[model samples]
Target chain A: MTGPHGYSKDKDAHLKRLRRIEGQIRGLQRMVEEDVYCIDILTQVSASTKALQSFALQLLEEHLRHCVAHAVERGGPEVDAKVAEATAAIARLLRT
Target chain B: MTGPHGYSKDKDAHLKRLRRIEGQIRGLQRMVEEDVYCIDILTQVSASTKALQSFALQLLEEHLRHCVAHAVERGGPEVDAKVAEATAAIARLLRT
Candidate 1:
């Protein structure tokens, strides 16, 4: 299902964060092109990874607060399914 | 310390991957802009995160195969320091 989903409320903020991350990724490319130190590049990679994770966490929080909460209020099998889906997504985040 | 590190050998490949990741991040921005589903966005985030980690692993492999190995071949406290530094980087990767 497409959206206007749970994260729609923070869409601007999320887009801004993603753009910043995009810039960071571009910076890494420049580092590679310029032959920057490996350790420094690796450090930047870590920072980028962390930024992606942080963004995911924010979106997930909103999903739980909105989508999952609504499903829970309805009190049906869909609630269980929504919760499970959310959990699986969290697992994916952790695995990375 | 910069310019022509171990990863320089694969500089083109690394730059290619980083550029792809930058594209992915931009895709994410478009997704957010279009208001794609929360779960779908999260999935993309995981993919991007995995891609970053994969790039990092490749870099680390080269670093160990060349830089760290060189330090060990030198036979001194430099070897120990290099290993420690590498281990610390690994730790940072894990925590993220």
Candidate 2:
């Protein structure tokens, strides 16, 4: 909901990663279709989940380096808001 | 890889869920393309992660209900192997 977000500069790379993860999800579908072993499917799920966490971490790093830091430089309540937001995001990630 | 695996009976449902998740991944790509807020994107990532976990949970349920149960009924070392295999899978899921 914001323009030129922290990840905007790397949008293409982000899309590429998302697409690759999408492919992994499709691979999981195929594994199910072919009746692959349960453990094998579970392993793929974990891989996809791990890939997603990595993407989140990267986005978070950029957010802190850019958006959050920018908020701090602006010298207002925005910095607190950004830090709280990032913390919430991190908590959601950890729970997942 | 083994079939008819525990999930084979519900193959269609599993495939459908995975396709939905794939769509979510595509949605994430669109968000990045549109330069959505970093936190918003992170929220969606958590959602996708949660969905994957749900799918894994369902698969595990079927695995325990069918595969593990079958193994137990057969009354061999298979029961031990299946239980151990499932425990390992759960550990992996927890780590993710």
Candidate achieving the largest TM-score:
1
Model 2 achieves a DockQ score of 0.85
Please provide, for model 2 over A1-96, each residue's C-alpha lDDT reduced to its tens digit, 9 standing for 90 to 100.
568978888888888999999999999988888888999999999999999999999999999999999989998888888889899999999898
TM-score between candidate 1 and the true structure? 0.97
What is candidate 1's lDDT per residue for B1-96, written digit by digit as tens?
755779998999999999999999999999999988899889999999999999999999999988899888888899988988999899899989
Q: Which stretches of candidate 1 lie over 4 Å from their true place?
A: none
Docking quality level of the chain pair in candidate 2: high
Candidate 1: tens digits of C-alpha lDDT, residues A1-96 = 767788898888999999999999999999999988788888999999999999999999999998999888999899989989999999999899
Off by over 4 Å in 2: none
- Model 2 residue A40 CA deviation (Å) reads 0.6
* iRMSD computed for candidate 2: 1.1
Give the local distance difference test score of model 1.
0.92
Q: How do the candidates score on chain B by TM-score?
A: 0.97, 0.94
